[model samples]
Target: MRILILGTGGMANQHAKHFAAIEGVTLAGGVDVDPARVEAFNQTHGIERGFGSLDAALAWGEFDAIANVTPDSIHHPTTMAALNAGKHVFCEKPLATDYAKAMEMTETAERLGLINMVNLTYRNVAQLQKAREIVQSGQVGTVKHFEASYLQSWLVSKAWGDWRTESQWLWRLSKKHGSNGVLGDIGVHILDFAAYGAGSDFSKVFCRLETFSKAENNKIGEYDLDANDSFAMTAQLENGALGVIHATRWATGHFNELRLRIYGEKGSVEIQHRHDWSKLLTCLGDDIETGTWTEVAVDPVPTNYMRFVEAVRSGQNLEPSFRHATNIQKVLDLATVTDRDRSEHKV
Candidate 1:
């Protein structure tokens, strides 16, 4: 299978690396806005073809699929182009910054009968899969309240960028370059995870976004820095479960932490993914003090990339499909609206 990757920044290389590991996949080439990045990415990944634009790549590079690793703002366009070109697309989430555009992309893919998958990475995690199964099996009873968080300390100080060749911190802060800051970047992952584990959709959201250090730390001409650095929201899942979502790039001393807990009438489940994959935890009975949260073992499944490839090969519908992602995007769009209304009332 031939696959062309779009965007040379962020996790593009990681996507390339994983695609190369697939049994029958080839990394045809990639396109980037930066010529230097295009050259560097090609050299580092050992891909032979590189293009300056998506049109060039699509025209000249023959491929069966596109792994779009572009920034959030361009996700809709890139995926649409790939789908229109008759290539399957594996896009990173939240599908698009614009909710209407996201819906259009989803509809286009469906209308074309193309295999479209969203890179909601956590859905591919083994422990989380186990958690989902346990909850869906009625082992946990009906979910009541849940909390999930994705946290990182990169934006706590500018030093994170000094070490990496490319850091998304500044671009993420620019409304022109990126999508919703902390919420879109990390919070979406939490929402996907919670929704996947709880076996329900989000019915409503009440959100609060923060950009705490940007005003004080940013130099006058440095950056507009309008994107959020942190966010917290409460949501009601379709199962009547009350859930809380929190994400931030300003947490000190933590590199990357994603943790979730789902409580139910009979028991609760907790899962965490950080430096290493943690075990799935489950507790039965109603006794809080005396109950024990034991670890539940889970067998590994194929990576998200592998699943996408398999779906493409077999003509099967992909999980976390474009439609699934659009629902998540709707929650995010509504969250922003809810936040705006609440903030305006406070004024």
Candidate 2:
């Protein structure tokens, strides 16, 4: 499949490498507003063409699929344009900044009969998938509680008074941009894990959100401060299971640690991806009478982009349909809107 990537961001770089590694999928090329990024991407990946605008690339190098890697603000337009162009699409996670636009894209893809894949990359992680399998195999019995958290220190300590904190990267931290904050970013991951593993959707949410520090990005003249730096939520799932999902970027020592533990009547399983380590640990309950805690080896995960490629060509269902990701988005939405106090706004 010929693919065109549509952004100059870091995530755009990741998708570039991911697809370049695949054999059957052809990297048709890319388009980005930033000249340096566009040039660098084409050079690094040996892409055939690089356009300065989405329009030129969409017109010049007709693509079979598009990787929408731009910021949260443009997901809707970028995706809609590509779908209108009759191209399959792969958008970075959180789908859109919010559910409405995300759903629009989903429905547009569905109406146009296109294959749309969202990059909730963890769903493709072997350890996470292995944990899900362990739970579903009935070895875990009835799932009762779940603990999932994603942590990082990038935002808090990265020269706090920057445009990112100020309104410079305002679109990201803004509630309009689907609350592109940690909830939209990492919360989506755990929500996906919960729904995908337990086969349940979120019912209601109550949240405690805070922005600990905000230094003015003197140069950007934007209100640079904390916005949902920390989010804690208690949720009810469709299956009557209770869940807690916490996401924060203010942790002092941790850097990109994703930990998930699912408890059940018969057993429990864990997926721990901390730094360079990726592990899946299981503890069996009394049902077996001789159950014991054991660590299971998770298989290596293939890039879901490759699978989406196969699905487009063969008319097979993508391992994760957009519908699945939307369910995850509902949880994200719940966290953002549930405890809304009109006067209380973070950042």
**Highest-TM-score candidate:** 1
Q: How many pairs collide in each candidate, listed in order?
A: 0, 7
Per-candidate Cα lDDT values, in order, are 0.83, 0.74
What are the TM-scores, per candidate, against the unseen true structure? 0.93, 0.89
lDDT of 2 by residue, 1-347 (tens): 78898886767778888887778777887888888878988888888788898888878756788888887677888889888988888888778766677788889889989998888888777888888787778888888888888888766555334435444355455554445577776788877776677656776667777765454442223333434667888776776778788888777677678888888888888788876788888888663466566788766877788788787888765857676676666666666666574222211
Candidate 2 matches the true fold with a TM-score of 0.89
Candidate 2 least-lDDT 10 residues: 217-226
Q: Model 1, range 1-347, lDDT digits (tens) per residue?
A: 99998998868988999999988899999899899999999999899998999999878848999999998988877888888999999998888986799899999999998899998988777889998888999988989999998888876655456312234666777566675887888777889988898888887788998876555554224445677888888888878999788998877877887888999988899998886656788897654557888887888888889989998999887798988888888887777887888731110
Model 1 scores worst on lDDT over the 10 consecutive residues at 158-167
- Shift of residue 124 alpha carbon in model 1, Å: 2.4
Compared with the true structure, model 1 gives a TM-score of 0.93
